[model samples]
Target: MDTQTLKHLNEAQREALEVAEASRETEWTSPSFVAELFMGKIRTNLIFPYPEQSPEDRQIGDEFMKQLESFLKCNLDPDEVDRTGILPPEIIEGLTRLGCWGMKIPKEYGGLGLSQINYNRAIALVASYCGSTAVWLSAHQSIGVPQPLKLFGTAEQKKKYFPKFAQGAISAFALTEPDVGSDPAKMTCVAVPSADRKTWTINGTKLWCTNGLIADVLVVMAQTPSKIVHGKEKKQITAFIVEKGTPGIQYPHRCDFMGIRAIQNGVIEFKNVVVPAENILWGEGLGLKLALITLNTGRLTLPAACGGMSKQALRISRLWGKEREQWGAPIAQHEAGAVKLSHMAANVFAMEAMTYYASALVDRGGSDIRLEAAMAKLFCSEAAWKIIDDLVQLRGGRGFETASSLRQRGEKGYAVERMMRDSRINRIIEGTTEIQHLFIAREALDYHMKLVGAFINSQSSFSEKWKSFWKCAFFYPKWYLGLWCSFDWMKSYAGYRPLSSEIRFVGKNSKKLSRTIFHLLLKFGPKLESHQMVLARVVEIGTELFAMACSCSKAISLIRNNPSDLSPVELAKIFCKQSQIRIQHYYDALKKNTDPEDRTLSKKVMNQAFSWMEQGIIPDDGAGFQKNSETTVPLEEKRRYSV
Candidate 1:
């Protein structure tokens, strides 16, 4: 965005964008499949083979999953855990005994050294049975100390902490505070350096720190002292490793949530908590980047877990669809129920294809998967939620009943209601759905930002602007013209005969999608980001295109080996047609929508013009809501928490 347009934003929006811009991975050192899609290019080679898990790796994961399935079947009672809001000690011990704690740690550290594919398989298996248990294991390593320590730690740091995870030590990530939800720029948590620079003192309250209540170690983010460079001051956020017995660390209360009832999430308070400088995982000014990088990979776990849950929903829906009759016939035979059932099956197939493909990319390494991972998280989470919602509707009243209640009435409980409650959190964690849209949009624009920023940036000198304007003038006409009419004869998907139509749609519409973004950018200029709905539509279109391509790629791979069963290809056809319908709807909305009217109405609504509209409803003022005293620290004291 240009400087003049930035001036139109409120202080909070400006600060958040500024901090996020500073920490962004500005260089695309490696090629990204999704990023290229935004650039009007499709590298079919990347997705064509649909990278498969090696035979040995598959055997290893299969053996581990078998053991995990036996353990969960024998010991886990998910309904009981949800009712009690506590995971049993014996279950945690059993997981540790099975080496779940060391699943992500490298074998050099005497840990499991599981590949990303294997780890995701294990997570998916666990999640199929219990949501709380999945969170318990994933939270310990996905975004926890082990992840950062392995990614950014010194050799000595890894040597010190890796062994602990293998020995059943739990860990947590502390970044979000009471006031700061998604933006770390507003973070008031501070770590102050000692006079000798040998120790750092941290003080702040971290809210919703998953696994914090019982974690043996923590990776805490805090603002350090700022530095002046090039006539500007830059904020510094640092990551630290704090141990369990740290004197000033306290968890005074645990948080109760709508779902995942057995999680050990709580408020963690740090008061003058001091640690040696060596505890810094990366460097003083690189904490936000570290967290973002860690999450780029950690986000994979959620989609796989979501796939697991989606599979379970499919199973329950299938059994109920046949067993329950309505209108004098099996529900599965009814038009509405039949449509949902077919789409549910098709969606599950695509969900597995997209997530497992991304996981395989991670295991393969050196591919820029930022866009791919974010899209996987966004697509799979939303798709899984929709699948579960359909399951509930299919089950009718039984879906809303608790499993225990159903069992008490002498009926077999499928746990649809519990799954719905548990699945809602996926859209909120890692990053919210709205936040992911913004993140994807920002990265999608980055390629153009680098190419033409000097031309459009208000901060640029007239001489520089003149050169950039002429550069774009010479470059874009040819580039923009190709997006409209260019045809690549050599770009035909060779091995994708069964699903060639879907592949062709993605290949063709990807260019149209990029062209649409170009026109929108031209129309809105630097103020385009403020037009969020328009950008969201563009993102959804691109996401659908990615899904269709993955589905086609995986279908080809599956049918090649079987040679007889083309069920996977048939699933791909259903999923791709579904995605095409969605894409067209998005395109239609992009051309015509009530955006201007919406802005005006939203302003009036927030200004209390609609207060009269709510006169019939019971009056509620939120006074009954309990505010935590621990987070309501005084302002003067909050400064004491800052650097």
Candidate 2:
């Protein structure tokens, strides 16, 4: 699993792997809590303080959220937005007047200049109320031009774009093509420089471009000329600031999806679109790196978004649990209902701690939050969906009904079903859950791979092997020996009163996780990366362990400050105990699982071994299926289309 495994990878995979590895932020400028936990070291200091947002920043968020909440409640009708598949122009105008457009931009640029925490809080609030509205804003800032501009824009680039964003100009990031989702190496979009070398002519089509239908500007990623490095040809992806009215830009089609339907998303086609060389962000050959780093921090939004949505779900569930009656009593009193309610509360608490902690790290600066942010996104999205699902179940048939329908039928319509649909896309956007797991696994094992991977890799040169062998010999033995020794006796969880032992459990099991990883590395050697199930289990254990630490730290911090209330401690304790059970189950499954059988069955299924099982199903061919319309529309027709 080294960056480019040349041994057996085909051209496409090898290139994809190489491009992705090249894009990774390879420096370790600061300690990462999740990164160390995977290495068998619980960097307690990183998580212990809990990274609180400053009072000044919190106040800013509070005031803005107050205004936003009020405006949304009074003016925005989410059900209508969903039903029409259109966010009203008046609602957008209201948001603009509130300066929602500039929430992430700088004050120097005529923007709000809210801290990361505050920006996240705004997103969370928006998401809690309206998923479509949240995307409308988040897409414009999160991975859109404003984000990359803030991160990698040149001074000139910033001067031109920042004010536009401040003036309520919407923006989008265009990276996905019709055939490409996560794999950018296979990207066919090309930007070729002109004879004068002053501008580049780009030709490509971008798919699923959120806000593309109405965005004022876009950050488009396209492959530039290749560069030869160390006797190998390397792909170079360059980011450019492409204005909406650029001559050849076309909105060929609009995209409708299962959720977030009000978002003005669609397919964007570029035909010989020319742009000045000054638009190149962070220089040529750094577009993917820019995207990755932008996403590294930008990805924090969804986690906060998930946390907020889950909070709403919790509220809806609690009311239903108390009011809904069945089985001779209120549902909340039933054993099964009680467990679900408690877990929902606990999980929501953990989600808050996880999301804010990561956002706080972004605001604090000098902290490596790549792992933390991804874990938060991975955990919160999945957790929020479950929370919303449980809300639906608790509401029984009422949950499945649309809020409008419920109102029509004379029932309380809380939008439980809508929430479920909205909650699902979080797991898929930013990155899919499976991709996040693999991304985390790759990063979690980065240190190990750097230290000893060459020693076991068949493709390593003799000298490389010699170097890595020495590195391995000097590192793993001492690391392995230390794992068996308990460091708990030397450390004390002083402020963690009722949950001190749970905090210690995180420390202890971290060692076990590290040992398990080391053993897996030994058993599978270079092929361990192929063992997706094993790595998934290992990642899950590490994630829950991380969750336990965050929950404990946050709960202790809360209870200490509010000594009169111990409910925070109670919630943390419940979450940690449940996390403990899950962690141990994953730990046990590592040694005993049906992964081999699962893989066997998967291959057979892919080979259509079970085609006969489809005999009883509806028997129609996919007659309606069609590829996206091509990018060759005539100029007259294209010009008639509105942006």
Candidate 3:
């Protein structure tokens, strides 16, 4: 089945199809289940299987979660557990014992050595109770110390560090400073080499260092002067492992934050600190590369926290909407409330599906999953924020009160605020959204170029979408011209307002004209390279749309193969519809370029690209969802395991 045919299915039919395909061990409450429903039958059937693990790994993951959940039950809820914002030592010790700190470490080092998929499952569990807790745990797992060892550390470094580090030894990632962010090349921190290159001295201040107050180890990046080959003088930034109490390392009291307050975020002043020469990560100048790789790894793990938060937000809204009614019936039964709930559901489901896909890709050893990770982080963070915002709205005044679950606290709002800020940072970190687009466009263009070359060289004609797209190229000029005019009109209206009674607008200002202009701008408007920022946004939306489509398809296939396993596919289908409509809006928006010039070119280029995508796009030859060894809690198992 094609995209359109699947789009035509009723919600009930889609749900039924998904229910028939899921495994018996997966959870109904999971975003994975919802993701399946979101994809439906046709798309799912088309994109059936991606290889990675067997059902055994999934089982291990589930069992681990169950054990961890039982351990966390008493600690997670009940009583106001130190909301005064101290990183409790007890919690740290508990996490260490659970192997949370050593997940990425090799199995030989006493770490669980779990894959990215299982690690994210652990993160989701932590996030469900407290996003703050997840943040604290992440500081140790992602940034602290173990990461550098895995990515850039020497074999000896791993042997010396991974064993002890895996035992929950706290560590700090000292990078951010008072004046530096986003741009590390501009950092002023310096590390001058000693006479023999045997020991190096460091001096710099690192601000916003999580776990700094109690960490036993530190990964510090600084500038080092290296002799340039054929050049007079040179300096490069490098990273080093600084043991705690290394002379000159000092920690200021932890900095307070808007959210995730329980996590320790502090300032570390490296006043003439000293470290061994052999401690450098992949030698000098590779610090940036090491940082980027570690971040990519962290990005894979970030989405699960957001997924958990989104789930929590949905639960909050549902409970409040049902109990707090304006009319005789529950507010959830009302149209306005229903719309809000639907939107929240859609966002969460889409985020979850995308996260799952990204994790799966990473687990399968796909190296270029950075863009996917970024997309997951961006979408999931935004979705969680929206859900929380709506949940707050649903509670009206009560949600604003500090007495609500930590999810509704003023700081909870900040957790989202920071999450958004942090999420945006990632968008620009590994690659900006603009950069991702450039990467995507380049990939798309390459694929198309190959197709055209094949056709030109072999005289072969592609079928369906490709042929139709090639045909649409002739209509480019008309579309491009329309976009230019629409933009001109929009620019003209910027200074004018309809809110004022005296304001006057010109050039056929009716609903029809508005739509005509909008339609034209939607397609060709995004073609303006001069407005690269806007173009970046347009592409970002497009990427989300495409990714959502793929995710929905994947989920649907999973559900179809194991219906009893994915009962929640019914809910997922609703969310899938939501993603489709949202994506369509962007597509429709791109279609409305009133500028004639852009309309012309965009039509031709878009058609050309469409043809290429179709010819090159390989559909999943329905092997159905392979029974992977993913440790999942199917509805029946959860029911049986219920204490």
Best by lDDT: 1
Clashing pairs in 1: none
What is the RMSD, in Å, between candidate 1 and the native fold over all Cα? 7.2
Cα lDDT of model 2 by residue, 138-184, tens digit: 98999999999998888888899899889899999899998779888
Off by over 4 Å in 3: 1-53, 77-82, 226-235, 404-532, 564-573, 584-643
Per candidate, the number of residue pairs that clash is 0, 0, 70
- Write candidate 3's Cα lDDT for 186-280 as tens digits: 56788988999898899888888877877888788887875564453334668898888888878766787656666677888889888999989
In candidate 1, what are the lDDT values of residues 1-643, reduced to their tens digit?
Answer: 3333465678778778878888888888988888999988888888988999999999989998899899989998999998899899999999999999999999999788899999999999888889999998999889999888888999999999999998899999998999988999889999999999999999999999999999999999999999886777778889999999898999999999888999999999999999999999899989999989999999999999999999999998889999998889999899999999998999999888889899999999989888888999999999999999999999999999999999999999888899999999999999888989999998998877766777777778999789888888887899899897776555666567978768878888889999999999899877888899998999989899988888989989989989799999999999999999999999999988999999999999999999899898857787886668887888899899899
Look at candidate 2 and tell me the lDDT of residue 58.
87
The global C-alpha lDDT for each of the candidates, from Candidate 1 onward, is 0.90, 0.89, 0.60
TM-score of each: 0.96, 0.95, 0.67
- RMSD in angstroms, all models? 7.2, 6.8, 21.0
For model 1, the run of ten residues with the poorest summed lDDT: 1-10
